[model samples]
Target chain A: AQTVTQSQPEMSVQEAETVTLSCTYDTSESNYYLFWYKQPPSRQMILVIRQEAYKQQNATENRFSVNFQKAAKSFSLKISDSQLGDTAMYFCAFMTHVGGSARQLTFGSGTQLTVLP
Target chain B: GAGVSQSPSNKVTEKGKDVELRCDPISGHTALYWYRQRLGQGLEFLIYFQGNSAPDKSGLPSDRFSAERTGESVSTLTIQRTQQEDSAVYLCASSLNRGSLNTGELFFGEGSRLTVL
Candidate 1:
């Protein structure tokens, strides 16, 4: 079974600063995908970033990026230039293909991020 | 709809009452997912549907929880004799298809908050 872990329960950052949310996973599958999702006060689960295990290159989307260390089973999300809008609950999830079909996302507990002005 | 839509955004019912939550996936999406998120927690995958066929229902907590989807459109999750532990935000997400290993990203709805007293 795959499991995701987010050690930080809460995080805070000042506007224009950077914040990094840590995530780790336990999976035996060599081919898999990792993701970070942000849920705002509106309760909409928005995809923040994604990383494919086969690729060594870290995925970056604008100010959001991920450091995926396959050997360590660590996939951490870095949010640079944090804005007030970044205040939300962030979750780290893992996905893998099983018998040519991808399985459902396994998520970590989550990290509550608050951006202070 | 422009995005995944979930009905009864907020539901409050007494324990032992049955509740039905609805989710309308984005048109053309062949894969739909249901997740449960307790307050301040991460997403718990409940079920996954690929074109009306559920290949993964392993995340469902108990027998009281069941879900069904019609053709590639709306999906309904029925909770029989709801318990207080079922009080959480039920989130619905959809993707083009789970078979697309490289480019599929789950688009989520606002979620339906269920509270059982």
Candidate 2:
């Protein structure tokens, strides 16, 4: 079984500043995928960024990027120049590269991020 | 619609009552997924369906929770005798193909919020 852990329950960042949310996972499988999802007040789950375990380079999407350390089993999300719209609950999820024939995801508890003006 | 659609955006039912949630995946998507998000918490995988194959119901919390997908399109999640603990947002997602290595992005719906009193 794979388990994702987000040690921080709550985080706050000043507007226009940068913030990093930490995530760690336990998985015996060598091939896998790591994802960060955001849930806003509208209750919609949106994909933030994703990293492939085999990729040595981190994944970056505009202001959102991931620091993926496969050896350490760590995948952290970084949000640059945070805006008020970035305030949301962030979750880290793990999936098997083999596909959902296994049909499941292991998610962390979540970290509530508040972007203060 | 361009994105996945979930019906009955909000549902409130008394304990022990049965509730049914519906999901309509993207037109050409062949894989659908169901997940639960408790308030102030992360997502919990529930079930998954790919094309016309038997669904992977491994993530369902209990036997009381069951889901079905028909014609590789619409899906419904049914909870029998719901408990107060069932209160949460139910999310649905879909992807083009599950077997492909490029299946990284998942389109999500606004989610159906279930309130069990």
Please provide, for model 1 over B1-117, each residue's C-alpha lDDT reduced to its tens digit, 9 standing for 90 to 100.
Answer: 899999999999999999999999999888899999898778889999999899899989999999999978999999999999999999999987645543557999999999999
- Interface RMSD against the true structure, candidate 1: 1.9
Candidate-wise lDDT, in order: 0.91, 0.88
| Regions of model 1 farther than 4 Å from truth | B98-102
True contacts kept of each: 0.76, 0.59
Give Cα distance to truth, residue A73, candidate 2, Å.
0.4
Model 2 pairs whose backbones collide? A100-A103
How would you encode candidate 2's per-residue C-alpha lDDT over A1-117 as one tens digit per residue? Answer: 889999999999999999999999999998888899898898877889888788899999999999999989999999999999999999898887664433456789999999999
DockQ of 1: 0.70
| lDDT over C-alpha atoms for residue A72 of model 1 | 97
Best by DockQ: 1
**lDDT of each residue in A48-109, candidate 1, tens digit only:** 98887899999999999989899999999999999999999999999986555666889999
